[model samples]
Target: MITALLVLVAFGSSAQSGYDLWLNYRPMEASVRATQFKAMMSHVYFAGSSPQLQAAREELTRAAKGMLKTAIVNTPADQAQLIIGNIDQIAKRGDILKLSKAERPTGDGFIIRSVTNKGRKAVVVTGGTDLGVLYGVFAFLRHVQTNKDLTNLQITEHPKMMHRILDHWDNPNRSVERGYAGFSIWNWHKLPGYTDPRYTDYARANASVGINGSVLNNVNANVIMLTPAYLAKAKALADVFRPYGIKVYLSIKFSSPIELGKLSTADPLDPQVRKWWKDKVDEIYSVIPDFGGFLVKANSEGQPGPQSYGRTHADGANMLGEALAPHHGIVMWRAFVYDNNVPDDRAKQAYSEFKPLDGKFNDNVIVQVKNGAIDFQPREPFHPLFGAMAKTPLMLEVQLTQEYLGFSTHLVYEAPLFKECLDADTYAKGKGATVAKVLEGTYQPGKLTGMAGVANIGTDLNWCGHPFAQANWYSFGRLAWDPGASAEAIADDWLRMTFTNDKRFIDPIKDHMMRSRENTVNYMTPLGLHHIMSADGHYGPGPWTDKMPRADWTAVYYHKADSLGIGFDRTATGSNAVAQYFPEVRDHFADLSTCPDIYLLWFHHLSWNYKMRSGKTLWDELVDHYYKGAAAVQGMQKVWNGMRPYVDATRYNEVKQLMAVQYDEAIRWRNSCVLYFQTFSKKPIGDQYSKPEHDLQYYRSLHYYNVPGLGTN
Candidate 1:
């Protein structure tokens, strides 16, 4: 009897350490909703019988069983209480839901309505295609999970972008570049024979948020992936992801024709190279019919490309685009390139190289540009290339992995960061021409539109290394589907599904997440100070790392701190990088008086005694921001401590321990930056904050090599 009681107690208090992500349907919270769901969702009449539909059926049944404690039964279409299928399938029955002509959705849109047909109450979920039907099911489940009443449901949602994708930086041997999570989830050696169940779960998580595609390999491409043996392994994974509406793409080495096919030259203008690519593309299509095309990282960071043969980027991209275009696929030619030999600003290289060749790209080619001109810094001005490319299609690339914002250890919410870039007023087509509008084809309607993120997924039990880090993945997919969606609203939705929906828990936690990005910025790269991460590993602060293989690779090169002042002046008197933007933005950012203080150091160097808007000197203001950010982490600890009653013990404890580490790291970042910068400013630490524990020489002597995600380990 004692043993039985113990077992019941353990079962009742099951721990959820975030393995399920936001899809954790943790049982019914409201009795009335449960009863309504049980009554209205008993018999599901699904007309389609594809593998995609099978996945949807299983998802609905799982949610129904978990959320309503009801077993979903399959009944005839005429007698069922719920109906799900494409529009054509529903139209054959006639007047099932009586959806208005104006209500009809096209593309990947769907419609979910609670209707009455022949005196029988039923909820009909129909879409333009089978993929849309699957999306509708996930949407309906979200509504149920969020405790919204489904009595008179009317929701019509279609993706704003055609391709919502995740770009994995996974290497062939299982190393991930800039991936702060664990190792790559793709087990290349075990593939073709052992299909990990986790692959299906990965697809389900992405599909739930409207993400439709994933590039399986790193942009720093390996030519071996094009070999027959690797293609078979990729086909295996693609087959598993097919049911969840995901199309797998690959990153091909630009010199693959020469390296893999033993051609004399991989030049785009060469006939043999062109034929080789066509044959390779055909081989890929045969293996996986629904295969997406290549994502090339060419002529950047020593990656081989057409530049080696005096050919342009468009020349390289168009060659691959022509090969994939015949198969209804595309080529995502990366615009994240820089010149090591050029003395010009590294930020301006991509714009100068690609802007001239914008209109020259083929119809099936897209230039995938990074959010910032520089590497993924904690804070950066939006890339000027967004509005500059009028004739060419450009997709915004944001990093979901925390390479610069404290890796997987820090609790940094990235929705606000993404929204910042998307909502920036480019003034390209007039006053309200936002970056989001430009990418959505507002100026050029005939072009394809899309957004991509560098994925942080790996082999950890919780998926993302940090439990809170999972929210970045959720936010990326949500924003990719609809750029106009508010980050705060998305955070609230994720919070409700991932944890508790109680107002007491939601209100405070949402506030914490919303402030997280800025808090990290303040400590790591406040007031436009960027890319000061410690060498190669980028694990911590290293502002004094002045010597490296190249001047651009060092922290001192960008910050340019000296005895006179600090900052990289991008005004006409300096590099004139601001000229890349529209006249409105160029003038505003160029003027020291007009530029916001948040980006003051980014555009111009200032005296240490210069007065800030806060009426404090620049030195005092910088030190204050650093100290306050570290203190905020302590406050976060207090907030999490108060919500122990609401969160599961496993998650609560995990976050608590992690927050403790974050507090220490926050202190490390704050002190190291302020102390190092002080060497140049020749100023004392702010009176409010404590002095650094060690001297500048002491901090610089510290070493942290062989960190995870550097591709070495």
Candidate 2:
């Protein structure tokens, strides 16, 4: 009895540690909503016994037990208060719920409704398939968690993108590139022999938000990951995730034919190379039948590709696409490439290289484009490729890890950043052609659409290093599932489910999350500034970093801060990079007066003394943004402190300490950039703002060593 009680205590403690993520399923507060949910979940009938159906049934039972404080009794369809199953199974009951052909759930879509038949009342959750049933179960739990009433429920939902995936940059050696939370969660050394329970929790959290795919390795691919030994380990994980409706994908090295197969050349046109990949793909399928396929990063960042043999990206992708065609798999060929030898705008290289190859790729090849033309900066215009590739499928890839937004130390909610790009009008097929529409394949129907987030998950106690950082992971999954979802609404649900239902706690915290990305942008890269972080780990400001192997890798190459002016000029007169966009977007960005102040410097070089939209000199306006950003961090500290009574001591204190560090770092960023840029402006920081704590030389001389997330490369 003592051991059992100890086990119970241990389980309770672990539940509050944030390892459960947003699916904590804490007990609901006593209220009308709680009573309603308890009654609705009292007697449940879940049809079918497949692994996917069983997983859904398990989740429903677990959630009901936790939130309603009662065991869910399995009952016949007529006696059950809640009926859960696929549409056909639910339809077996006569005249229970009638759905029109258009209203019926399709693909992975689901519908929830309140119905009455033969003097019996029940809430029926039905979907197109077993996977859809799993999603409906999660959505039903979310409604209860957010205190929503289910009496008059009429909800139908479907994922906006066909593939909502997480791209884990985790290495085989248990290190994660750009990961700030902790080491990689996959213990590859022991994987095939031992399956960890954490993997299930990870799948649960992902499924809760409708993420259906996971790529389990870094894009900087390794040949060993394709070996027979590792294949068995990956199969182990695939088996665990299959029940949760997640397909496992692996990132393959482009030269795997040569590196792993001992071939002389990995040319896509080489018959030997082509056969080698086909065999490897066959072996992979034999082990994991539901394998998602390969994600390739080639001809970029020194990774080998078909370019070595003078072949185009389509050649490389098609060769692999042909191998996986039988299994209906795809090749997510990354479009993050640039020639360091070429003296051109780095932002234009991807468009210049890929725009012409638009129609060349096979139907199974999807070119994964980053959200921005460049890497994931604090703020950037949507990638020009979004609407440009009408013939080829494109997937938007956003970073969930805080690589440039202060590396998990600062509270930066990324939903706004994602929405900013998704909502931007691409004007491809006219005014309504937003990036979201392009990603949803609205302009070009019957094409695969997807959104992949760089996974920020790790082995930390909180999963993410910062407690609030988990919100980024949550937000990415939510937005990927429905690009049209509001950031404010998502934050509201997250706050209530993760912390408390108290309005006082939810209201102010939601406001903080909504404004977080903008605040980080203000402090770190206000007014169109990009890529000025320190060279390696990207932890701190390094506006003076000009010594690098390549000019484009240097901060000065992008910012171009000189005595004359600041910012890179990408206009027609400059690199003509603006021409890459459709005329509507190009003309808007090209004209200085019309360009948004937020992106003023990204597309043009402006004088320090140029008049600003706010009627202040450019220099004065930049200074005010820096000060305002730092001050906002202090405001966040005060807001969080007031919530001590609402949150658990563990999570509340974790965020409290992290906020303090955030404020300190915000000051450092403000002072470092303000002082460094002042050298070019030759203007004094206005007396209204506090002077830099130290001189420019002091900030530049500061160096940090052994920073986390600098995995391998």
Candidate 3:
């Protein structure tokens, strides 16, 4: 299958393990279960009929029946083996069933463990709320699915970020922006009548990862979505997601006052425009009372905003936030704005526009900032805006789609990227001011916190295009729930759920994924080389690209590979973009010698002959990275090949075949980039690696003009 057409579909044949994702609820081999999970089914009891409660009941029932391949009989007896209940309903049973409260300060926490219920052995699943019950059920199912002993399973958990959302850049026309997955899941034309079962599965998968909200449209939004007709379409999805505790949000076009309401001006200060938005908010909430509010893309990349009327970003955000305040909704204003025709550095634009407007936003507004200052690159330093605003609610926005990372073809686990940013010490209010602390409300008081991922899900049978890509989605939710959680821990849980819990499968795969993103960065943009892909499609290498209208838009702007040196000088002598960060961070990137070598080239241009810490000249080190990256991918293929017995034949074969594509492409990336940059360095391939198969011109001629199943995010 082409890289772009991987869609999320629920059903696969009973003969294959690919369909189950990490939730493969297949009946365990009788011998294995008898020794491991048989204690899970001595008795069963469930209390409550709320939709969320029923959801938990149904999920557990389906999983248990599927894995055990037998009816788990309900027991009315006091010592039910699998006892389940909401906190209020379960407390009545008293000491006869002493269910210790799970230490979850948040509403969504669950504990499942063995306990003696009136002298009878029981496995109790109890939580403070229905959502907690749902989490408990999933947790319980995971234990059984992973063939773990159910005798003493005690777990309590809650989301770290108040709002973990998936922003689907899906349009009514079925086009998805930057989506490698198939067409949009929202079938607008048939939505009011025909409901796709996929919606339920999407919600279920998100709930499993503790993602509680989803914005159903693109940030480059269309005003038509707010109209009465489309609101009906959105309401259908909201209804399906409500039971799963996932509130639906919409991406609003700032010019909606003019387009949707037929007003003359969409100025933020105008009373008519303010009233128009307020009325629209009221209308939307009337239909979907729990509607999660608006995500706006004002004055960025052709999107209209308050800037159109000489108002700051705050003016636009506060105007909409005021409207949503009464209804308990929020306005997520994007901080991705950069002037289209300006010659200024792209990295400096967003900070310049947003830093001054920080404290002016309404309390209900969250400034949605991307992980990096520039657009999503193969690698980038954490965004300067993270700790710049001390008095405002802010949300971290991460891209799960792999738009700039080799798309679906490359096996890049993004948990490391997420962790790098979350763990970055911002030094805003003093030491220990991490980005996680800022958004999670640990450092800042009374501020609503959030994290969002640009979803890579679509209509594919497997959910994310690549089966392993599903893990990225899983990791994003886990990290959002608790940024302190280790990437390996999250990957371990996902491996057990998506595949076998066998050490052979888990250990090897985990090692491969943990190192995969770094390996990708090593080849594609080592030493901070970024945004060097083909002009339009952004698929392959195009480091020689130039002559665009804006100087910053060209690859030349980022990788200034001249005889003088290479890299954008963000130091005082250059763009001075480093000054945007806090002083602690500012000093780190301000000096070329002091700047971390990983970002050495990003902050300062260096002569090709400059000796690197690796004891090799800069030119040789760059070549080594390209070679090393390609070699690591080959190593991944070998690891996967050895695990043929651990995975289903279909998924195993799918991944195996894709590995061949990745290896071929990795070589292409290596050769093309190395050969192009070698022109400036005037260096040899060296005796360590083989010479390039083709020259730069030959590599450039291999035009991928026909992008199969491309998206426009």
Candidate 4:
């Protein structure tokens, strides 16, 4: 009997192992709110028989059983304490619900309100469509999970963007590009016949946050993904996600006609190539009727594209767009291209290539631009393409994987980084043209708007490798759903739902999460220093990395440190990259006196003894930021150590150990960068600062092998 009890305990613990994400639905403590929730949820009336409706019913039943510890009895709509369905299904009881026509939710939106029906108190969860009703159910559960009062609850929500997507860089072989977590969750060898239960859970987690689409494979395309055998595999995953409102998309090889169909040429303008693409898209739709569309990465990093045939980006994207248009599908064409042979600033390449072709793309094609001009640096000013491309629909793509920010070991909450980009003013129309507004199509109505996060998920027990890394995934969804949502509030809700609602744990931990991104920026790439990470895997500090086949790929190309000064010069006399933005924004960045300290180095190369706003030399200020950033990681360790009683032992210990690793790496970054850059500055290592543990050569000689997330091109 004792042995059986031990097995049961282990099973119970395993069941709660971060696998459920924010929907764990742990039993509520005895309280007035719990009693009220239990009473109200004792009987539920969920109507309709659609698959989405069934999914909602199952979710509500599961949540009730877990949180309230009671089985909900199916009751007639008139007698039930809780009524759930689409608004039209419950229109007969509209008198008590009192929903105004203006209050009615449009698109994938929902409304939840408390009402009285026939002298009985009831709460209604509903929307305009079945998918909306499903979203409403999750919102209602989140309300209860956060311990919010339900006495007079009234809530209305609608997604700000039309398409919220997770772009998984999982390869056909199960290796993920820049994935820090374990192997890809998709067991391709076993898929199309044996669907993992984890796939269903992934859909549920995404649905809970209003994420509606997913691209299944790496942007670095595989020809096999477009073949019949693999299309069937994608179809199986789509079936699991359909009920949750997630439509599956795939990344395609641009030259598939030549490789797969044995065609002589794969030029977009060629009649044979166009016919092949059209037939392939039709074949895909026959298998997965609701396949969202294709995401293409072309003419960048050796990926084949229209440029190979001397054709424009539009020619290639329009060819795919024309094929998918008949199926009501869209094509997401990435704007991350940069020619290595070009002598211009690498940051300016994407804008230069795509800006002129803004109105040239087909209606179904969206120019998917990265959040910043460069790769996902620790921090970057908003991409200039955001406000410039007025005629074409643009989708904001941000990375959730911690590639350059310490690869899942460091506890960095990325909500602030996301928010920083969203909140930046573009000065497109006037003063208040924020990137969020541009994404919402506020200035140009009736255009498609979307956000895509490069997923950090994998086969780890916690999904994200680091326990705290899960918060970045959660934040991405929330911000994608509503760009104006508060990062702090989202962090607070995640903490309460994922761990505990205790105030002691909530307040300090929330502050730590909010500060995490900035702390990482300070230690890794402080003051607009971008992309100086070690080559290939980008695992650690390598500010001195200069030798490479392409000059733009080296660290020395960006920082430009010399005996005179440091930083990339983008002013009129330099690359003139600042001219890409609107006049107001260009002026702010182009003028040395007006630029923000955070972005000082990005736009100007400055003297080592240049006096900063704080009356310190540029070298001194740089040193101070590095020291403080490393110290902040120690502070994070202290914060997590104090929360041991609140979080589960498995997660608590995991985080505690990861925190130790981050602190050590943080020190390494500080020492390596300071010592290397000190060579050019000829400055003293201040007495107040911590001395480097090893000489610069020792840090430079260190090489890491077998780093996770290194994908083959």
Q: What overall lDDT goes with each candidate model?
A: 0.88, 0.89, 0.83, 0.90
* Candidate 1 structure quality by residue, lDDT tens digits, 1-713: 01123323544432354767888877886578777777667867998887878888988887886677777989888787789998878888886866567777666789998888667878888888888889888888888778788788888888889889999999998999888778899999999998877788888989999999999999988888999999999999999999998999999999998899999999999999999999999999999999999999999999999999999999999999999998999999999999789899999999999999979999889899898999889889999998999899999999999998888889999999999999999898889999999888889897988999999898766778888999999999999999999999999889888898898999998999999998999998888888788995888898888889888889998888888888888999899999999999998888877898878888887788888889999888889899989999889889999999999987888889999999888988888899889989999885667887887777788787688887831
- Provide the lDDT at 191 for model 4: 86
What is candidate 3's lDDT per residue for 1-713, written digit by digit as tens?
Answer: 11121232322353252445566676677675553454446467787788998888767766666677665667774757678887777778765346444443247777776777778667777776888888778877766766676656666666678889999999878888888777898999998787877778778888887899999998878778998999999999999999999999999888888887889999999999999989999999999999999998888877888888999999888999999999999888889888866667899998888888778889999999999988888788999989888888789999999888777788889999999999998889888899999989876777889999999887766667777888899999889989999999888888887777789899989999999999988878898788888776788777888978777678998999997679889988999988988888889888756788778778888899988887999999999999999999999999999999988887888888888888888898899999999888888889979988888899988887755335543
* Model 1 steric clash pairs: none
Q: Lowest summed lDDT over 10 consecutive residues: which window, candidate 4?
A: 1-10
Using all chains and alpha carbons, the TM-scores for the candidates as numbered come to 0.97, 0.98, 0.95, 0.98
Q: On a 0 to 1 TM-score scale, where does candidate 4 land against the true structure? A: 0.98
lDDT of model number 1: 0.88
Q: Per-prediction RMSD in angstroms? A: 3.2, 2.0, 2.9, 2.3
Name the regions of candidate 2 deviating beyond 4 angstroms: 1-12
Which stretches in model 3 have alpha-carbon errors above 4 Å?
1-17, 30-39, 96-106, 708-713
Off by over 4 Å in 1: 1-15
For candidate 1, the per-residue lDDT at 552 reads: 88
420, model 1: CA deviation in Å?
Answer: 0.2
lDDT-wise, the better of 3 and 4 is: 4
Worst-scoring 10-residue span by lDDT in model 2: 1-10
RMSD to native, candidate 4: 2.3
lDDT per residue for candidate 2 within 1-713, as digits (tens), equals 01123424654564557766777688887888787777667767887887888998888777887777787778877777788889888777657778777888987889988888456677888899988988898988888888888778898999889899999999999999999999998999999999877788888889889999999999998889999999999999999999989999999999888878899999999999999999999999999998999999999988999998999999999999999999999889999998887689999999999999989999888999999998999999999999999899999999999999988888999999999999999999999999999999998788889999999999887789988889999999999999999999999888878888789999999998899899999999999999999996888998888999888888999999999989989997788899999999999999997999998889989999999989999999999999999999999999999999989888888899999999999999999999999989999989888888888888888887999998972
